[model samples]
Target: MKQMLAWQDISRQGAHQGIARMHKAHRDLLDTIELAGRVRSEHPQISCRDIHYAARGQMPRGRDWTEQLLLSCGFRVKTPPRSFTVAGQGVCANLIEGMSITGANQLWQTDITYVWAGRRWYYVSFVVDVYTRRILASHCSRDLSSASQIRCLSGALSRVAGQDLSGLIVHTDRGIQYTSGEYKRYLESHGLRHSMARYAWQNAYCERVNRTIKEGYLQHYTTDSYSSLAAGVCRAVRLYNHSKPHRGLPCRLSPDQFVKELNQGLHPDYRVNIWSKLTSTKMLYVN
Candidate 1:
C-alpha cells in the first residue's frame, strides 16, 4: 500500500511538470505571434519571407515556421489589381534589346503610373536604373503632362551631373508624354539616347517597379489627398531604395546596398543581360 501511494505521488508530480511545460510553450508561441504581428504592421505589403527576415533576431524560427505563423494569424498578401497598357506611336528604336547592363547609367527605364487619390487621379513618373534596380527619381503630379516626365528626367540627370551621358540609353513605352517633342529635345540636349518599347513586357523593368511601388507600399498607405499620396510615394521610394531586399540583386541586397557594393568593387563579375524576345537568340542572364 505504501509503494502504491509513492507511485501515485510520483505520477502526479510528473503530470504537474508536463502541464507547466505546456503553459510555458503556449506563452512562448503567443510572444512569437505578437512579434510577427508587429513586423507585419510595420511592413504591411511585404511577403511572409520578407517579414520573417525582418523579424530574424526577435523570432528564432525558420522561414517556413514564420510563414505558417503569419498565415495562422490571418496575415495574407493581397492580390494586385489588373493593369492595362495603351498603344501609341514612338519615334526611336529599341536600343536596349539584348544589351548587357553591367553598370549604372548605361541604361535607365522610365514609366508613368496612375494613382487615385482623393476624388481624382494622380500620375507618378519614375526613372529607375536597370543595373542597380534603384529608383533614381520620381515625380507626382495631378496631370500626365510631358513636364512631369521632363522633371523626372531632370532629377535623374542631376544625380549624375558630372558624369558623361553620351551613350546612356533612356528607355520608355510608346506613351505620348515620352514621344512629345519637349521630352525628346530634353533627352537630346542631355546627350541621352532614346529607346522605346512596343509592348508592356518590353519595358518589364520599369513596369515591375510601377507595380511594386503602387501595390506593395502605396496601396497600404492612407492617401486621402494628393499631398498625402505624394508623401506616401516619397516614403515608399525611400523604403524600397534603402530597406527592401531585392532577390534579383546580389546577396538579396537593397538597391542602395547593391550600388554601394558595386562602387566598392565587391561584385566585379556581376552582369545583367536584358531579356529580349526581339533578338533571334534569347539572352537573359543575371549574375
Candidate 2:
C-alpha cells in the first residue's frame, strides 16, 4: 500500500511534477494578490471585502486563500479610512452655489481625469460650456500632460470659432494642467476671462461631466478586453455627448439637444437667469 506524504515531505524524484504545479499555482495566486494590492493602492477607498468579492469568479479563489494571499503579499485587510472630500473650497470656492452664465460660450469649465483600459491608463480632458451645459470638446490620450489639456482647449476654441464671448468666464480646478503658464498664455491671447474654482464645488459642473464619463459610459462600455484605452474613451465620449441626457436641463435633453435649442433661438421662455429667482424670493420676504 502506498502512503500519503505531506507536501513538504515529498522527494525530489517523485514530486517534481507536483512541486512544479504547486509552484505555478502559487505564482498565479501571488500575481492576483499583487494586482489587488495595486488596485487598493490606486483606489484607496476600496475595501478588502470588495476585493474578496471581486476576486471570486475572477481568480477561481476562495475567501480564505484570497485573505491569506493578500496578507502574505504585505496587504493588510482593513476598512478603508474615512474620506473628507467636499465639492467647493480652496481654488474652487468662488465657482459654486450657482455661477451665472449669461450667454452661449460665455463660460467653459474644464477638468482632467484618468481611465483604464485593459492594463494601461489613459487621460481624458474635457471642456464644457457652462451656460448651455454643452460639451464643447473632449480629448483622450495616453498621457496626462499639459499638452493634452491644451489640445482639448484648442479643439474647443476651434469648435466655437466666430462665436462671440464678450463676458466669457472660463473656469477650472487648480490642476497643474490648467495652471500651466502655457495654458494661461493661450487663454490670455484668446481674450477669455479666467476663473478658478476656489473650492472643488466651484468645479462641480465639470466634475459632474466627469462622473458621467466614469460611471456611466466607462463602466458600461468598457470590459477587461478593451482593445485600447483611447478607443474606449473616444467611443464613450461620443456616446455621451451625442446621446445621453443631461439631468441639469429640463426635458432631459442631451448636450446636442441644448445646442440645437440654442442655435434655433427656441428657448424664448426658458429660465436662463439664475439670479432672478434668488432675488425674487428675497423681495417677497422683505415685503
Candidate 3:
C-alpha cells in the first residue's frame, strides 16, 4: 500500500513504435531515443556530447540524464571510455599497419557491436579475414563477454581444418573482453599473434563489416524478437559471402567465390595481395 501510494502521482505513457515512452517517472528513455534515432541516422559517428550539442534545448533533461537515456536506447558514443593498456611488449607496436597480411587465414580482425531488437540489446561479435574480406565467424549473445568472443574464435578455428594458420594474427581493440587473462591465454594456446589498436581507426576492417551488416542488411529486417534478428544476421551473411559480388575481387566475385576461385587457381591475380587497397573509404566509429 505504501509503495502504491508513493507512485500514485506518476503517470504511465503508452507505447510508441513498440516501445513505451519513458518520462520523468521512468527517465525519458523513449523520447530521448526518438530524438537520438534521427541524429544517429544522419551521423552514425555522432557521440553523446555531439548529440547533446545538436539537440541542446530539446533534450529531455541534463547531460548525464540524457546520455543515460540514449545509452538505454542502444546509442553508444564513438569515444569509448576505457583507457588503453599494454600487454607483454606493446599493443600499438604489434598492430597490422605494416604487416604483410596477404593470405585469407593470415590476419583476422575482430570487433563487437550492439544491435537493438525491440527493447532488448544484443551484442554481435565477428571475426573478418583481412585478405579475402570474408566473415570468418560470428557470435551473438546478450552480454559482450570474453566467453562470447572465445566462442566465435573457437568456431572459426574449427572450420579451418586444412587452412594454413601458422602466421595467424588476431587484431582487436583494447576492450576488457579482448584483454582479459582468459582471452590472452586462449591466444597463446592457439599460437595466435594478437594485436590491439590504440586508436579506433586502426581496427577499421572489422568495424566496416559491422556497419555493412547493420545498415546494408540487418536494418531492413528490424524486428521485435532476438530469434528473428539472429536469423536475419545469418541469412545476410550468407548472401554477402555467396551472392554479393565485390568490385575488389577478380570479375567482381563474392567473398566466398573469391576464395573458391583462388583455391582452384582460376583467379588470375591470386598472387597479388589486396590488403593495401582494402580499406573502408568512409570512417567507421563503434556505435
Best by TM-score: 1
On residues 143-164, what C-alpha lDDT tens digit does candidate 3 reach at each position? 9788999999997898786777
For residues 160-233, could you state the per-residue lDDT of candidate 2 as single tens digits?
88878776777887766666777778888888777776445557677777766665456555445434555656
Flag the better candidate by lDDT, 1 or 2.
Answer: 1
Runs in model 1 lying further than 4 Å from the true structure: 1-32, 55-58, 164-166, 278-287
Write down the TM-score of every candidate: 0.83, 0.59, 0.62
lDDT values of the candidates? Answer: 0.84, 0.65, 0.71
lDDT for model 2, please: 0.65
Model 1 Cα lDDT, one tens digit per residue, 4-38:
75777766666779889999778767877887777
Residues forming the 10-long window of minimal summed lDDT in candidate 2: 80-89
| Candidates, ranked, TM-score | 1, 3, 2
Cα distance off (Å), candidate 2, residue 128: 0.5
How many residue pairs clash in all the candidates, one count each? 0, 15, 0
